[model samples]
Target chain A: MTLALTLDNASVLIFALTGALAASRAQLDVVGFIFFAALTAVGGGTLRDLLLDRDPVFWIADATPLAIATGAAVLVFFTAHLVESRLKWLIWLDAAALAIAVAAGVSVARSMEVGTGVVLVMGVATGTFGGLMRDVVANEVPLVLKQGELYVTAAVAGAGAALIASLLADGTIWTTVACIATTFGLRAGSLLFGWRLPVYKPRPPRA
Target chain B: MTLALTLDNASVLIFALTGALAASRAQLDVVGFIFFAALTAVGGGTLRDLLLDRDPVFWIADATPLAIATGAAVLVFFTAHLVESRLKWLIWLDAAALAIAVAAGVSVARSMEVGTGVVLVMGVATGTFGGLMRDVVANEVPLVLKQGELYVTAAVAGAGAALIASLLADGTIWTTVACIATTFGLRAGSLLFGWRLPVYKPRPPRA
Candidate 1:
């Protein structure tokens, strides 16, 4: 559990720091930055656990992630002069978070023996939902709804890969590797190609 | 269930329209306003039902609420000039929704036979959590977390009143009235008196 928690906690810090940078960009107060960091850290998993009947949620059960988030938020707020403009860093940081969170969500859901469909949805949720909530809270339109290759679409592919791998292989390690590779590959491809769903357009009205 | 659906559908529009008003006050676009309205409408009950293991979620079980919210959102955006400024009317409208939501929460929880403490918590969740989410999404500190004697406090008092009444008397019209009145009275009093909890100040640093 300690080893596993290390993976999850590392992901939490990465996500929280990104959130703190965003708050600094917005010029929010220290308290506001802490709020944003904490929200980014736990918002998605909390939503998933609440929906899936997982109680004593991760944040509630392990307070370390939250404490670390608070610390990071405070540090960033006080030391804004130390870092460069976060625009470039924020994008890649968000991308890394999306990757790790998708993997973590798949692992958690798989441990519970949730079905493949649920796992896929949960993975996307774990990856994207926190950032979505953060964007909304920060008063920005969600990028996924605008010019992005399917955000959740790639996550679904990744989880599906893991599910299929588990059936074909003998070990959890192979299954996890397959899923992560598939999702990351698909997401990168989509990003490179600007692949997107066809825009909905209504036929012109008859004259 | 049909009758309940009809009533709920009507209320969803009312709540969303009011929420749209609130969102517009923050200068959000139509999409943002619609998102805010949806959250304000279902966010509270979703938390309660998920906690209580209620299936299919009330809004998802019937698409009526979603449709109503979307339609109301569209109307508000196109014809915002036709209506009063949303901020001016937000308090009373939010109060009314809170009154209705708290009563609905207590009744539903009691029907499910949830224990008193959990039931009271659910009531507060149903009545006030959505507004808290709304504030966060609007980039404001949540009013509930402030020192204000506001919505959550009223919901707790009202839920307590409902529990006591339901235990002592038959499930009559009076029970509903008592619950509603208690919440309304408490909220109104808080508003009128500018009631608030004392701000927390850290004690002087120790030597």
Candidate 2:
């Protein structure tokens, strides 16, 4: 449980950094940075908790995550310009956050003993929805939905890896490691090596 | 309770229509229409429920709203082009939905006996977040955040009216009527006469 909580907090902080970077790119005020940071930090987990009917969402139950997100936002608001490539930083941080968050989501759902399909969905949602909300709110196309990008696909594969490991292995640790490794590996490959799935192309209408 | 349920369903249907209209304008597929319709129909209430920690969210407890939204989407998918001005129809339908939804939110929160401030927040959230999600997902600047628009202001004022009416009147019916009247009146004025609140403008940084 402690490990899960730590992972969750780490993901929140990392995602908040990405959100703040996006806000800086948009040239928003300090309050906007904090708002975006907190929203992106909690959005996915909130959605998951709501869907799972978990009581008093994580941030509401324990204010640490919110505080961390706020602190991250303030730090970024002052230092974002020092980063020469905010977009590159945002994408890499987002990838790392996605890996950790997917593991956390899988842990939560497996502990709850939900169906595998729901677990997979929750894991992917937890991994991607925060960034999706941040980008959408910032008026940029959601990174998860960008043509040929492997964001959601990587999340799904990672969650699937965790599920398989859970069935094959004896403990939660192995499952979590599997999830993070697969998620981060795929996302990193996509960023570093331009790995991508084929995008859909419209065909001519039937004659 | 029946009255509240009816109002909720009505708002869901109207909101779904507006969402479907948005999808049509975006030129998305039929599936996209259904997704947007259901999303807009339930987004606000879902957020309100999550915040209030309402068990078994409204749509989860009662699938009727989801069904109604899906039906609205299918109907609009076939007939949207028949409307000469989809934007005009979307805005008017959205305004009506906003009023009904605000009343429903106030009713739910009041029934829970929460504090007035939380009730008001729930009211505005339940009225506006659905359309906000719809616009965001469609990659359109959210109507609520449009420059000086009375959208959110109308919802807030309407919710505030309900609170005042609740203090003065003896029944929920009076509060509901006041909410709907104020919300619709302000929104209509905004559309018809360009009524708006002053927007914030940034000052130049000091030398």
Candidate 3:
């Protein structure tokens, strides 16, 4: 097994955990939680594959991610209370997951030589949109649309960093790692400090 | 407008209405209902386009479907009770929507000369998956998944019928119409006679 494969699997686990956490909070049954977990874990990759016109959609092609996601969901079902007990650590874990997803998406897109803009947008989408879909499916307002800690903005910035690294370095592993670190650091800081975006308000009525 | 264009636009309107109807039944706000309408209407086509690697993703390329969906959503918001108040008639209208969507999807798949298996799946997907997505997004159990009429099954059958019809004919308008009729008739019969798949009950506990 390689570092990339390890990170990929970890990313899938993180993705599954997000859904499992949300589902457990919603008090869904095991089946429901697993369904949401599966959707959250592979939903973005599936969309990416479909948009890329690739066959067998990645999750369907390799069952590893699905297996991991199902396992994560089951684990969360039994141990949700334990994880919830550690409320302070949850934000950092979420930030880690978001950063990893962004980095992974950027890596794959650049490897495929997709255009810069597509790469950036798709990376942000892959990182944040799965959770967005998860929240939407779970009947909650999407975090991206709300006044959250600039989660998607962080993803976009991370994606930009990855793109720059890819363009500058001659396929060096350090470059990729550096980009991932940049994204992860930004997200972790935002989460720890409760950072937020400026709110948009309607203009005052004319006299 | 060309016949193909008419069929395409009609399919969009029908599916959009189906989504609007579902959202209304859920008592979603106007914006929420409009979102559901657009998702239910264009979601299948958008997925299809993505799978085929078609650029602009359909709705983003053509403003007509989006505009049409918005208009339909507005119309449904004002007249939702008109449909929701009558459960039976609305079911038939939804069936009609399924019919049109299946027909349109089959026609487009033929134009692409996609593989038979993928085409069949895509046709059914284009017909009913949007509604499934809407139900998931609206945080409700999908009607098709419950003890309801065979919606997706009928859609698949209709799509298969259209493919076969296209093969037998010159992809004539009659073939499409016949396919649509097959879908609608089957769904209508299901509604009128309570035709449904057998429920999967848990096996009796071993003695």
Candidate 4:
């Protein structure tokens, strides 16, 4: 439980930073920054909890995550302009957050003792939906949907790895480590080595 | 409860139609149309239920709404090309849905015996957030957030009217009627007579 809480907080802070950076790029006001930050930080987990019928939601149950996100937004609001490459920073931080969040999702779902399919779906949803919401609100083409992007694929792979690890190992820590390493490794490879999946190409209509 | 269920179903069908129209404009596939339709139909109420800590969200409790949305999506996917002005149809249908949805939200919140402020927030959220999700997913600027549009304003007015009517009258029917009339009337006025709120304009920075 402590590990899950720590992972959730870390991901919330990192995702909030990315959201605030996006707000700065959009030239939104301070309120907009806070709104985006909080939304991005909590969006994925909120969806998970709602679908799983977890009452009160994470942020509502404990306000610390909300406070952390708000603080991150304020911090970024003042210092974003000082960053040399906000986009680069945003991308890397988002990748890191995604890995941590997926692990957190797996941890939560495992604790709940749901089936493997739901656990995997929750992991991917938690890792990707926050960034998806952020991009949609900011009016950017969602990175998850970008042609042949490895974002969702990476999340799925990581979650699968965690499940596999759980079958072979006995501890939550090993599963979590497996999940984060696989997610971040694939995402980082895509960024640095130009790793990609084949994009769909339209074929000519039938004659 | 039956009245609330009827209103919820009505709004879900109308919102799903609008979502399908959006998918048509985006030139997405049949699956995409269904996805958009279901998301828009459930997005707002899901958010409200999560916030209110309602167990097993409405659609999960009753799958009829999901089936209705899917049926609407398939219908629109085949017939949307025949509509000469999809955008016009979408706007009017959305307004009707918004009014019905607000009434439903108010009814549900009131039944739960929540405070007035929460009731008002839920009403607006249930009215506007569905279309907001539709627009965001379609990558179109959200009609609710469009410059000076009376969309959210209309919802607020409608919710306020419901509360005021409750104070003055004795029945749920009266409050629901007041809410719908005020919301649709304001929205129709905005469409027909150019009703709008003042929008924010950036001023030059200090010289």
**Candidate 2 wrong stretches, greater than 4 Å:** A197-207, B1-43, B50-128, B137-139, B143-207
Error of 4 at A5 (Å): 2.3
Write the residue-wise lDDT of candidate 1 on B1-207 in tens digits: 643244345446666776776656655555545666776777777787887888656764556676687688677666555545455466767777777777777766777876889888877788887777777655666767656566677888888888888777856655556677888788888888886556577899999
A98 in model 2: Cα distance from truth in Å?
0.8
Q: Which scores higher on DockQ, 1 or 3? A: 3
Tens-place lDDT per residue, model 2, A91-196, is 9999999999998888777778689899999999988888988888778778977777789999999999999999999475899999999999999998888898
lDDT of 4 by residue, B117-167 (tens): 667767887988899899977878877545445677788789999999999
Candidate 1: clashing pairs of residues: none
Q: What is the lDDT of residue A163 in candidate 4?
A: 94
lDDT of 2 at A145: 72
Best by DockQ: 4
Worst 10 residues of 2 chain B by lDDT: B198-207
The candidate, 1 or 4, that scores higher on DockQ is 4
Give the TM-score of each candidate. 0.58, 0.62, 0.58, 0.62
- Compose the digit string of candidate 2's lDDT tens values, residues B13-66: 999999999999999888889999999999999888877798789999999999
Q: Candidate 1: DockQ?
A: 0.07
Positional deviation of residue A196's Cα in model 2 after best superposition, in angstroms: 3.5
